[model samples]
Target: MTILVMGATGAQGGAVARRLVAEGHSVRGFGRSGEVPAGVEPVTGPLEAALDGVSHVSLVLPMLLERAEVDRWVEIVAGSGVRRVVFNTANRIPPAATDVALFESRRAASDALLASGVPTVVLRPPVYLDNLRAPWVAGRLAAERVLSYPLPADLPVAWISHDDLAAATVAALTRDGLEDDVLDIGGPASLTGPQLAAAFGATYEAQDVAAFQEGLTHAFGPEVASVVAATYHWLAKHGGDLYETDPTAAERLGIRFTPVHEWIAA
Candidate 1:
């Protein structure tokens, strides 16, 4: 089988592309530049050209793109003879949070893909355990042994990893009988800040909204700060169940994942 993976340079898309390659499927990595992993073709052309002869298309939106652009992608994929499209969201929010732009963007993207009449599988992965390895947190985790973030010290989250999300996406892409399915692919278990720190051999520290926003504003400007701060603030109010693993997809795919500690250590 042949596949085109958008956002292929990112963690999620990168994982998907790599997994497909391991399965011996032809893979194309589509991103803004020519960069891509080994053993995959790189395509940096018009959407139509990228979709050429592609059997399947996988995507993880890099950022908030115009709805019209995504619509066009859907239109092209619908007529391109593509067998399946897997769209993965970084996180999934409750329906009540639709008013928020982040959640609305995902809902809008999902709607377009499903309406395109092309077989599609939407994957909603919660907070990733690999986030702890980010520079802002990883350095501190290594040097000071403290896990810092703008989250409550007690909020439980179902943290997943890139590997787990990719496995599920590949299953949906290769297996039969999963067309038009929206799956919440979470981690093996739910965990809190203190509990998360225990796995990392670190202590937990609260990164207040004020401090978090201030740092982000200085680094990325006010728009990003406001938007990101709002998300963390929202999570602070309503704790992140990112670590709440949903078993529906895993059960269907006949797959299982390592626990939070084991995944992190690996």
Candidate 2:
């Protein structure tokens, strides 16, 4: 099967493309610069041109954009005879909180993909473990010796590793009989904000959530701050079940999901 991976320069797409190549499949990476791992074909063009000769596609587009772009991409891919797709969607976008732009955008994309007459599987991964490496945690670890972010201290989040998300995406792309499925993939263990802070304290100092957010705003700007705040509000009000794992996909793929700390250590 020939697979075309969108956003191949980004984390999830990059990992998925690499894994597919390692498995000896014909993989083509589509992105702005066509920067892909060695041994993979790089296609530089818009989504329409990239859809040619592609039997399957893995979409990892940005989550904060206008929904129309996603719809258009899906239309192009479907029109081009792409039969299967694996969408990296956001788990936090519940029907009740459709007002959040990021979540709404991802939800729109998922809907578009499903309605595009193509077999599709959507993987909704939770907060990534690598998100901790953002300047919010890095600065906190450097100065205050702590890791903090907005959210109730006791709110538990099922943070999945990006590597695991990639693995799940690969499984969805390569496996059969999983079309039109939506799977929430997360880590084996869930940790509360305070619990995660304590875990970080084992290796670095523990800082307050306010300080972390403040540093994050400085590092990432106000738009990111608003998104983070909205995400924390969703977690606090609706809880972390948004990103909860079902284990079916992992079991079917025969790959154990990586734990949060284990990924962090790596």
Clashes of each: 6, 3
The count of backbone overlaps in candidate 1 is 6
lDDT of 2 by residue, 108-195 (tens): 7788778877898988887787777776566766677566555555565777877787788888887878899877777777677666
**lDDT of candidate 1 over 42-105, digit per residue (tens):** 9986878988889998877665466577667667766677989988867775656544566667
Query: For model 1, where is the 10-residue window of minimal lDDT?
Result: 93-102
In the order shown, the candidates' Cα RMSDs to the true structure are 2.1, 2.9
- Give model 2's clash tally: 3
* TM-score for each of the candidates: 0.91, 0.86
Off by over 4 Å in 2: 95-97, 142-145, 201-217, 220-229
Candidate 1: Cα lDDT at 223: 76
How displaced is residue 112 in candidate 2, in Å?
2.6
Q: How close is candidate 1 to the true structure, as a TM-score?
A: 0.91
